[model samples]
Every structure is written in structure tokens, then in C-alpha cells.
Target: MHDPHSERMSSTEQRAAAGLAAVFAFRMLGMFMVLPVLATYGQDLAGATPLLIGLAIGAYGLTQAALQIPFGMLSDRIGRLPVIYFGLLVFAFGAGLAACADSIWGVIAGRVLQGAGAISAAVMALLSDLTREQHRTKAMATIGMSIGLSFAVAMVVGPLLTRAFGLAGLFWATAAMALLGILIVAVLVPRPPRALATREAGVAPQALGPTLRHPDLLRLDFGIAALHAILMASFVALPLALVEQGGLPKEEHWWVYLSALLVGFFAMIPFIIYGEKKRQMKRMLLGAVSVLLLCELFFWQFGGSLRALVIGNVVFFAAFNLLEASLPSLISKVAPAGGKGTAMGVYSTSQFLGAALGGLLGGWLFQQGGVDAVFLGCALLAALWLAFAATMREPPYVTSLRLALSPAALQEPGLVERLKAVPGVADAVVVAEEAAVYVKVDKLQVDRTTLERLVEPAPAC
Candidate 1:
């Protein structure tokens, strides 16, 4: 018999994880490639203004926020691949439109269309369908890492690519990359064994209200919104400052981004290790937010010096990366038993909305009071976030688990209670329809063998 507790991912599972991660990387890289260069090159476009440039930068988030849940639901109805294909095609079309556009308004229209694709949910659902319960978390983490890597790479690559090909050329590259993503999904990803009735990873409609209403979850949602808002707003000003005030040529912006991202990524690792190992997540989170607020102030005061810009950026990203990595893990921990998917959905929507608002506000501030106003505005946002984060209690340090149930065990009326009684299982939810139990367990204390034995059927007599 196969070991239920085995951590080894099957070869097929490896292929699925790798293929999906690539899809995520390609799509994210495409979207993020414009971030560092747009504020500078975008000015040359017809009808360009700081406000319009910001709108163009953030327009995609509005569409992505609106459509992601619906697309996830649609994938359940029709099929995962169909939804994925459609989203990618739409994204490609949008990129092509932006690539050919001569005006900022047209670019904004293209960005909205790009976000309309909203394939993230479908891609995740497909991953859930393909992977075994034992290794699903690992698979999801792989995809998450790919996304973060893509964002960092985009920061460094955006400037180089923009200098070589201009803003329109960058859009064209994204369009090509989207098309490449479609091919990767078709050729490389393995088909699932069957379509399961319950998607443990996909959003659960009934859980949405509770997920949103939970006070801690609400704090997390607000935190992500503030985080992304700050990111979008800051980008709107950073490029402009580097070129206009810091006396750095636009083409050389890549080295600054490259150096800062490398420093930030390495600096963030130890904080994550300490926070998780020591269970000091709340303290870590609060500290990161405080540092973010200070970074904005640093920019507001001494941004004209190129040296200060580099140092401030490196520090800002370290905090930003730490918070970005922590928030989702915190969401998984704080979400109600069996409501993780819904909680994440709400959190994602909040994040995108924050990004949209950030771009708009950042542009408006820059227009009104130059880059200094943009930094000041971001500082105020960071301060508000720090206040909100300060009230959050420590998150329960538990890992989420999904266990497949035997047919006989599925008939047990007290399944949830029995599972809950197991040592180290903090919470349990049995989805009888799916013949599975989702549990949050404290690994250090959990008796895995006993829990599995209880869930397994009795031997034949």
C-alpha cells in the first residue's frame, strides 16, 4: 500500500508543479515588466500625464479584482484548461493592443483587458486537481516562489528591455510571453486523473462571508491592500525621481533595481526564518510595516541624492518582500477551519484593489506636488497600515492538511469530532461530499499515525 504520509511527490506531480510554476512566472513577468520603466518612457506617449500614466499602470488590477472569482467559478463549470486558455488568449490580445497603441488612454484600455484574463484561480484549481493531498502545499509554495522570483527579475529586466525596445516593445515582449505560457500549459502539464467535486484549494462560496467578517482576516485583507497600494504608488514615483532628481539616466535604472532586489531578497530570508521558528510573526509584521513607513519618509526628504535613493530602495524592498511573504502564510494560519480558500480569495481581491488605488493616488500626488508628494502620500499610507497591523493578535502557528477518507470512514457521523480529538489537530472540517477532511495541525505535537489510523477504514474480517 502507498504511504499516505509520504512526502515524496510523484513524477507526474513534479511535472504538473513545474509546468504550472512556469505559467505563473511567464504571466507575472509579462505584467510586471512595465513597472520600472513606464513612468519615464510613458511620458512620450500621446495624451500622457502623471495621472493617466498611473491609471495605465494600475488599470489591470481593477479588472483582475473584478473577474478572478468568477473565472475560478467558471473553471469549475466548464473545465480548468478551457478557462485557462481563454484567460491567456485575452491577456495576449490585450498585450498586443497595448504594444500597438500610440496613446496612454489606449494603453490603459489594453491593461484593463489584460486583467480581464484573470487566470490565477483556474491555474491553481488545475494544480489542486493534479496533485495528491499529501504534497499540495509544496506544489502551491513552488508556484508562490516562482511569482516572487518573476517580480524581482521583472524589476531588473524592465529597464534593460525598455531601453532596447521602448515601452511598446516591452508590451510586445509580454504578448509573446503570454503566447509562450499557453504552449507550456498545453504541452507540458499532465492531465488530472478526474474532476473532483470539492476543490479544497478553490474558493468556497459559503465561506466568503465568514472569511471577510473575521476580524483578524479583515486586518490581513487591509494589510495586503495597503502593501500593494504602497508598491504601485511608489513605482509611479521611483522611476521619475531616478531620472529627474537623482541625475541617473533611465537606461542605468536596472543596476539600481538589480542591486536593491538582490540585497532585499537576501536580507528578508533571516527575518522569515526567525519569525516562523520563534512564532514572532506579529512582531515581525509590525516591524516590517514600521520600516516601510520610514523608507517612504527617507524618499520624501533626501530623494535627490542617488546614493540615498539606492539605499532607501534596498531597505524598502527588504521590508516589502518580508511582508509580502508573511501575509499569505498568516492568512493560511488565521483563516477559519475549512475556509482558507475563501479567505485567500478575499485577500487577493483586496490586494488588487489596493494596487489600483495606489497608482491613482500616487499619480495625483506627483501631479500636485511632484515626487516628494508621492513619497509623503505613501508614508501616510504606511502609517495607517502600521496602525491597523498593530491591533492584530499573534497568528496560530499551524500547518493546513487535507486527508483523504476511506469509504467506510465517510459514513461516520462523528468524523469531525473524532478527528478533532486527535492530539495536535487544532481544528477539523469534514467535507463528506469530497470524502476528505481538512485540518489545521500543530506539527510538533500532532500524532500523525493515530490520526491516519482513525481516518482509515477497519481491516476486513
Candidate 2:
């Protein structure tokens, strides 16, 4: 039977969760603060062109995507905090370099360096070490919330900062934030035990092959890539549109983003509730994707009018936020037992790759045909993603569990088969080297007592 009292997160877990969430928030805030104003203000740099400016905006993603997994693996060898410390210092140095740059290419180089400081996987590994398995979902959710909040704050703050202090000032502020993040991690976060640090938190090289080839996982990965591509591409044109076509003054752009994000956030709540509580995730996903497609089309067709642009943005963010929240949950539900870390690593890489491509494509299209071309291109990408999403199977509603195994139990043959034979147990993977069983089970139908007894079998009479 489940113990209700065991569900509460311990004080140590709470501190670790809060500290790590703040670390993630600071880093994300630095990255995102440049997104809203770069298209407009970046033009003032020497040798700036439509394509180069687009590259400047998205250059970090290229390095980030390529190095994210490697950094995580590095942490496994050296320890998580050392990797984190090095990543933050590299990020700060990159931001300082951007702050001092005089040309668009210099800025791009700085952004590339910023992305080289990839620490997302390392941070997640540390979080896994700090919290028990049962409490991990809550810890991860906290970090997710922090990222979402930072993005919202960035949308409003980016323009205001640029207006106050110019493009270089924004990069300077980002450097300061990265430094602050280092301090937070050093002071607030505890070091994980050596044994727990190397646990299931880090990626397993052996799991990567199967994780990459998973069809459903591939679809979701493509969906994220497309979503980010559309985002980066739209921003390449959006700031310019707001000033020229929409007649929104440069200084007042923050209000539009503030209002749109607020409306979109409130609008997303009902769909989230309907999707999760009612188990209508596939329907919710399809509906959100359909809504995203229409909004892109709306941008392409009517973006010239300020009213239409504002309305389109409000709706766009509504769908974007929904899809952003839903995709990770779906990945978790679909991942093979003991393989989620690898699955998520690949998904994140695809997402960054999409951002890099989106920037390049958006810039080229805009140069060829202006704002209309960019929106049209995004619409086409959205349509392609919609087609892929339509074919995804309804994901299983199962929870993953990890249980330790005794030495004697490890010697028993057919242990995995026996666990899978239990009612409501969906899948089981027994990694003998780790002396652990990773299980997937339907909570409603699964008998906890039976599951527990099977994992730690009683001594023979």
C-alpha cells in the first residue's frame, strides 16, 4: 500500500530544489532577455545584415545543442558542481565578450561561446542526486516553472532594458546574472554523494541507440525542433513588424508582449486541466497544434494591421505555452523504463538544432520577401509539424518507479519476467550492474503491495 505521509519532500530536498530552480532561472533569463529586442536594435551594429542579425540571435543554440550531452557526461567524470561552475564562468565571459563587440559577427561569435557553456544536463543530474525518486517529479516541475517565468519576464524586460541602455547594456546585464548564478549554486546547493551522483541521473551510453531510433520519441523531438524554429524565425521578423507595419512605437513594444503573455497564460489553464484531468492529452495536443497553425497563418495574412498582429500574438503564445508544457510530459510518458535521461537529452538537442535552422531560414526568407515571407515560412513549418503530430499514438498513462534489489534477488533468474507478470506492470528493466529494477506501472490498476513484495522477495522458508 502507498504511504501518504511519505509524499512530502524533505527540507533538504526543498532547499536543493529552490536553489537549483533559481540557478536555471538566472541562466535562462540571461539567454531570453535578448530575444525580444535583438531584431530591431541589432541592426545598429557594424556590418549588420538581415541574415547575420538572425544568426546573431540564434548562434548560441548551435553550440548549446552540440555540447549539451557532452557536458552532462563530463560531469559524471569530474562531478556536477565543477562542470556547473565552469559552464557559468564560460557563459559570463561570453556575455562580456558580446557586451564589448562592435560588429554583428563579433556578437555571433559571443553567442556561440555562450552556447558552449551548456549545463542543462549537468544541472538536471544534480537535481536527481538531491531528491528521492518519488519527489523528483516535483523538483523537475519547479525548474520548468522557473524557466517559463523567466521567459515571460524576459519578454517585458528585454525591450525596456534596450531602450534604457542600448544593445551592449543588455549583454552586460546578462553577464552579471550569470555571475550571480554561480554564487547561488556555490552557496545554496549541496553537493551530491559520490554514489548517488553516478546513479540513473546521468545518461547511459548503452541506452542512446534505442532512444534515438524510437519512432514516437522522434515525432515529439521533431515537434520541439519545429516549434523552436518557428519561434526564432518569428522573432527575426516580429520586432521589425511591430515598428514598421503595426505602427507600435519601439518603446511601447513591451506592453504588447506583457498583455499577450498575460492573456495567453490565463487562456492556457483550462486546456491544461482538461488535458491532464480528463486524460485527453492527444486531443489537447492536436487542438493546440491546430491553433498554432492558424495563428501563423493569421500572422502571414493580416500581420500588417497592429490590431491583427496583437491578436495573433496573444493566440500564438497561448498555443506555444500549451505545446511547451505538454511535449515534456508526453516524452516522460513514452520513454522506455530506465531510459528517460537519454530520451530527454536527444529531445533537447533536436530543439536547439531547430532554433539554429529557424534563424538561418527566417533571415533568408525575410531578405528575399520581407516580413510576409517569414510568416509564410513559419506557417508551412507549422503545417508540417501538424501532420507529424496527427500520426502519434495515444501515449500510455504510466508512472516509472525504481527499486533497489538485494544481492540474493540479483542472483535469481527470470526476475524481470516475474515483475512484468504482476498485474498493471507495463514494463521492467533489471540492470544487474546497478542492482536495481526500473519499472513502469499503471497506478490505478497496480497493486503496490504486490509490486513491493516482488521487488524485494522474502527469504525462502
Candidate 3:
């Protein structure tokens, strides 16, 4: 049987995937840069408070979540490049506006605008457009890695940049990066080849609805949203907790971030390997969610101590990495083939929206009930995710088969029926016009020799 995951990506597809991943990382870097320093920076702005600062930091996610799918669908209508160009322009404008802002409210407005770019969904859809069915997961994984790397780098760099040049200066630099991204999309990225581009029209709308309604998909979507919300919310709380509660200096917070990230990165490797290689994805995901839930509870209990908080951070990051890596892969496996883009579009939107909501709610919770409230809230969200995740069925391993057949054979009566009789063929769709057969089969049960024989040319009469 053919192995879909083993299929090699063409050079062009690799380039497109790499380019888009870089673009995504660049944009995300700008967003994450403010997380570590937002509270201190807020003090410099007019009408700044802890609650408002959290909102300002998180406002981008709210807008991005809301707009991600709309932008993605727009890409489908106009073209990917046009939508990407528009998003970059919006991002640049938002960054520039924030750079010039003198008040916390002004920064909040800027963040909201920044989120309005919502280019992630569009970029992902474009990636799917550029890659073949078999190679799409690898492309998506590349993008996922960029996101994780961007966040890690931003945490280390955000504080250093704030110390060197202040928050406004950082915003100005982000604006420059956004402008550069626009130029890259316009000039560096090649347009999709004609054959690949034409297939967009054949993608049906029904696939979108089913994916959105899927219980498993919704669970994963909610998981992403909650994960980001907790992340953003934690940043809102962590810096203050470290400085005020833990006696750590503001300038030295980067050390804490650096350590947590290093530990999280290395710790996540084994679990990720087990999930992908051992086929224990569901079990691993559940374990991670359980860990997150327990971590939140521990944070609620032992948040007063610096060491406790540090240990909590370690656990949180480990779970975060696992969930981040696994969620999209799960979506790819479960999403209908034709509407994979739409499914991801919805998933991305939820993720951003969750980040925004987490910020808003976390800020409000901090104001109303202090650090305990935020942890309790996060714990509750994680519990819900864990429960939902537990109910999800394990997705089977999928493999796609491509067969070359003669037009004469396809035209012959009962040809399709003959092909269907081959052992271990779960589903077969013959596109005679393309001289290809698309087959879904159980990799363990299917025999390659048997399949080849079924499609072999007939002997001379």
C-alpha cells in the first residue's frame, strides 16, 4: 500500500511552505514582543493600569480571531496574494499606529487593528492550495514549527528590545517587518501553477459545514483557543507576579522565560515522538490536557512562591507545546479532503478569538479577584477541554493511492466495478479525465502487488 505521509514534496511546494512559515513567524514575532514588557510599558502611557494593560496586550487576538476566516474566504474569492497583501498592509498600519501612541487606550486600538489583519487563515489556505494532498501535512507542520519558534524567540527578545529602545521603538521595528512581509508576498512568492490553481473551484462548501460541526474538530478548536488564552493571560499575570510577588527584577525576567522555554522545548520532544511514531496521539493529547488542568490548579494553590510559579511554568509550556503540535495534525487527519482549508480556517479563527477573550477575561479576572481568579478560570477551561477530548474517537491512519490507467480501460464497462473488487480498497474515485484513480485504503491490510495487478493493462487478444 502507498504511504501518504512518505510522499516527497516538490521543490516549489517546499519553497512556498518555507516562505509562508517565515512570513507567519515574522508577523507573530511582532505580537509576542509586547507580552513580556506590556505591564511596564503601560506605566509610561496615560491611564495605564494592570487590567487595561492586559487588554492592550490581548486585543490583537480578539480581532485576528474574528477576521481570520473571513480573510481566508476572501482569498478564495479574489486570490491568495491579494488577501495576503491586504493583511500585511493592515498589520503595518496597526504597528505604525501603536508606535505613535501615547496612551494605553491608543495602544489597545492599535492592537485591535493589528489583529484585524487576520492573515493566518489566508496563509494556511494558500499553503494547502500550493501543496498536494499527500504532502500537505508536512507543509502544515513546517508552519506550526515557525509559530512555536517565533513565540520562543519573541519572549527572549521582547524584554531585551524594550530595555534597548522602549516599546514604541519595538512597534516601529514591527511595522518595518510587516512592510517587508508585504514585499515578499508580492514579489518573492510565486503564483500557484495552473493545475493546482484550477482545483480550488472544485472544492465544495459542504465540507466546511461538516468540519465545523464535527465534535472532535470543535474540541480541538476549543483546546487551541483555551491554550492561547491561558498563554496570553499568564503573561499578563506572570511578569507582575515575578517582580512583585517573587522578588525578581523586571530586567531579569527574560532569564526565567529563557529557562522555561529551553526546558519546555526539550521536554516536549519525547512525548511528540511517542505520539507520531508510536501512534499514541489520542492518549498523549489527553495526558497533556490533564497535565495542564492539574498545573492550573497547582498555580492557584502555590502561586505565592516563585519556585512554585517556575515549576508551574515548566509544566504549562510542556503541555502547550504538545497540544500546539498535535492539534493541527489532528485537524488535518479528521478534516474532509475537499474542505481542509475551510476546516483550518475555522480552527484558526477560534484560536485567535480565544487569545483575545483570554486577555480580556484574564484582565477582568485579575481586576475582580486577583491571580487566583485567573488560574481558577484557566483550570475550568482545561477541565472542559479534557472532558471533550476524552470523548473524541481515535482517528485512523489514512493513506492515499494514485493509479495510472488507460483511457480505453476507463471507458470500458465495469472497469470501475473491477477496480473496486480489489482487497482492502475502502473507497475509490476514478477521475478518468486525469487518467488517475484516487483510493483510500487501510495500509496494514492492502497489498501493493494485488493493487498493481488490478490496474495492469489487459493481454493482447
The lDDT leader among the candidates is: 1
Which residue runs of candidate 1 sit more than 4 Å off their true CA positions? 1-5, 197-199, 457-461
Question: Candidate 1: RMSD over Cα atoms?
Answer: 1.5
For each candidate, the alpha-carbon lDDT, in order, equals: 0.90, 0.88, 0.78
Error of 1 at 450 (Å): 2.6
* TM-scores for every predicted model: 0.97, 0.97, 0.86
Model 3 lDDT vs. the true structure?
0.78
Reference-based TM-score, model 1: 0.97
Per-residue alpha-carbon lDDT of candidate 3 for residues 1-461, written as tens digits (9 for 90 to 100) = 33444457777688888888889988999999899889756678998876888899889988887777667667777878888888999998999899899999889999999988888867876886777656765787798899899999988998888888888988988888898888767666667743232122223354566877788788878888888888778777778777777788777778778888889999999998998778788999999999999988988888788888788888888888888888877775565433445566677778888888888877888888877888888889888888888998886554445555676656656655776676666556566555655565566778655665677667779
lDDT of 1 by residue, 1-461 (tens): 44545779988889999999999999999888888988999999999999999988888999999999899888888889999999999999999999999999989999999999899988888998988777888999999999999999999888999999998889999999999999999999998766553535778888887886799999999999999999999999999899888899999999999999999999999999999999999999999999999999999998888999999999999999999999999999998777887788888889989988988998999899999999999999999988988998999888777777888888878888887887778899988777788888888888555677888867779
- List where candidate 3 sits over 4 angstroms from the true fold: 1-8, 195-204, 399-461
Local error of candidate 1 at residue 447 (angstroms): 4.3
Task: State candidate 3's TM-score.
Answer: 0.86
